[model samples]
Target: MDALSKSDPMLVVYTKMDGRLEEIGRTEVILNSLEPLWITKAMINYQFEIVQPLVFRIYDVDTKYHNTPLKTLNLAQQDFLGEAFCNLSEIVTKFNHSLTLNLRNGSGHALQGTVTVHAEETASSRMAVDMQFHCLNLDNKDTFSKSDPFLRVSRLSESAVAIPICKTEVIKNNLNPVWRPITLTSQQYSSKDDPLLVECFDFDASGNHELIGSLQTTIAQLENLYNSKAGANFYSHKGQKKLKGQLFLDKFQEKVQHTFLDYISSGFELNFMVAVDFTASNGDPRVPQSLHYIDPSGRPNSYQQAILGVSEVLQFYDNDRRFPAWGFGAKIPRGSVSHCFNLNASTNDCEVVGVEGIMSAYSSTLYSVSLAGPTLFGPVISKAAEIASHSVQYGNNKYFVLLIITVCNIYPHVTSVQKFYPSIVVCRMELSPTSKKQKILL
Candidate 1:
């Protein structure tokens, strides 16, 4: 498209779904280069049972739209270069998990360029390491007083790019500073044998940081330094000059963190539980603005959507689909405000048959019960803990998951959750209609 300068190329990825193309992601436009290597990665969930067809299209973005955000940019305004098509399974089955395909035009004629696709399985290990660092004798870079020191740890990629993993807080006016312990996960470092770049910088107020010293080492080497009670000497950016500053490891501990998949693969069952908020803050059930309002056109409300989204994925992992459902901040028949009550309106049994049974019970409770006072999470969490504790006592390998759906503020009862169940992993998801973003807290 460019006569004087090279073509500014960008790549768009799509997946064929039900006879239509759905865009998965797009790469950033590379300016003035015929061969462009993009750093942006498009993540896709690969299913082993089905064949997923992927399409890759290249475009030359105009110079006027170079400053536009990739998400908002219109692909119809750009010039089409070529495209390639392949199945996702083909790339994964390769020896090195990489495949190269020749590009073709709209008429299926061969083009000049070829695109290479590489598949890398994401690391599922949740293992992490914690270590505290301190400097012995550091080089001073400040003119008025001692230099404010901080440390930045980065992992070297296969292309030798330094990707920063974590950094320590800057201690003002200190030459030898002891930093607090920092944790590094296996996903960040990839492996203990992988090399890491540790750089000590003198923090400047004007944003121009001066590097005092740096060193290249691995996690295994740092562990050895902690065991031997030794310190490693720092050197300049180039290896020719060795500085007087020394880096010492104050503490090092490696934790074996197991992932969700690890537990499931080891014959552990996941027990699903749900709690819905029935407070007056949700507005009336008959109004369209209410979050708990059911539509006559069969459209689901926000609460129903949350239940379906989580239960559908987790139901396959559970051996029995019986889920314990409850409601909070509501008043039962001839009773005061109850923090927790069975969703099915059964006095003795709280467990529902399946996802359909849970949905039916929830709908029934909305009409039978009345919305009441302030929402409390302590009771629901305590009840879930009691079930989990009973299963553990009987030597049943089961993990309990409690999903709480509420629109009201939970700050009052958030602290008491740990007191009730310390070992339970709580994941809070906030979904908003005005905003397209979703926040997940783990």
Candidate 2:
């Protein structure tokens, strides 16, 4: 807990304003240049970036010119740039990946335009994205008193300011409550590239009929909804060329994920093998001070704890929903020495999978036997590799024992031949010499 507190992945976003404070007997409230939109969208991780260090609102519904509807709705927009990411990437990078904009023009009519990105020569301390904003700037900075500016900026609150992602839905009059899907409702319907068909029911001053337009959903519109309502609605497909949709595993944290799920098998089945190290130096368990001591409460010392942790997490990954846990080292804890003992063959590993098996083994071994050590780790690796090394007699999901070598010394003796086994690797955990308790992901 103490170790975690010191570095709990600092998850804070700080934004402060700095200027010539104030003169003589006066003070001015610092204003933000851009706006913050804390939007929670199930459809996308939507965000906006400014190039010229200008601040603007991040919009959900795209518009060409925003003047009326933009003024009414409460939007959360964040201001960065003057103090944020000024030197991280180039200004063009921000523009090249700009968010789509569907806003209304100063003429109170909707207009469409794109804010493209480009990069300029690096200056100052680092490189930045050079930008090209094509939208009408309106040259109305002095008119920015929040009273008449068509585009306005706001501040991001201290709270998460995270809006709950709205579920897929269909709205009306531009005021229709965003729709939420129910059972059997297909989200395959898209509003892309089509016009919204509104079933409007109203009468004009002369009793003439009128029908308002709204986006309708269907498979033909695979990615679009009612777009006919607003001719500019097609802008929803803005910068489609820029979007390469689909997820890739390359972006995932491999170590953490592999530690959790073993997708090594081509078919859907569970099977795994486990092996332990029995090198000399693991002091006798009968001794209370050893890392493998069976504490009064009956938990293995840290050496055993590592095995327990690995076993605990692996039980869930093993096919047949079971695993074979074995130990190596000196002779057996019993009469003759058996190189391997199926830790969970006699009893199931864990109900919830993984760690439970190791824990159960730890509990069962407490009253019996003791710990010994020789300190050699090569045999531990070879033992696990032996199953696949000599013959083709293992399961397809054949994961060899992860020889958790808890020795401060031994790496120097390791050679190339030992490094050839892909499935066999040593998780070296030195109980001493570490300046602080380390929790390396691997």
Q: TM-score each candidate.
A: 0.59, 0.34
Tens digits of per-residue lDDT for model 2, 1-442: 1222221110012221352211111011112212232322111111122111221222332122223343343322311112112211222223232333333433445445322222332121121111111111111112223111111111112351322211223222222121222211111111122222212122233544232221222222322212222121211122232221111111111011121112322332323444544444555556765555567786556756665545544343344444445554535444444334444334333222345665565445433433344455555455556654553354454544453435445465334324675554444445531231323223
lDDT of 1: 0.84
Candidate 1: residue 307 lDDT (0-100)? 80
RMSD of each: 12.4, 27.1
- The lDDT values for all models are 0.84, 0.33
| lDDT of each residue in 191-301, candidate 1, tens digit only | 999999999999988989999999999999999999999999999886568999999999999987765445555676778888888888777778887777889999988
CA lDDT for candidate 2:
0.33
Candidate 2, TM-score vs. the true structure? Answer: 0.34
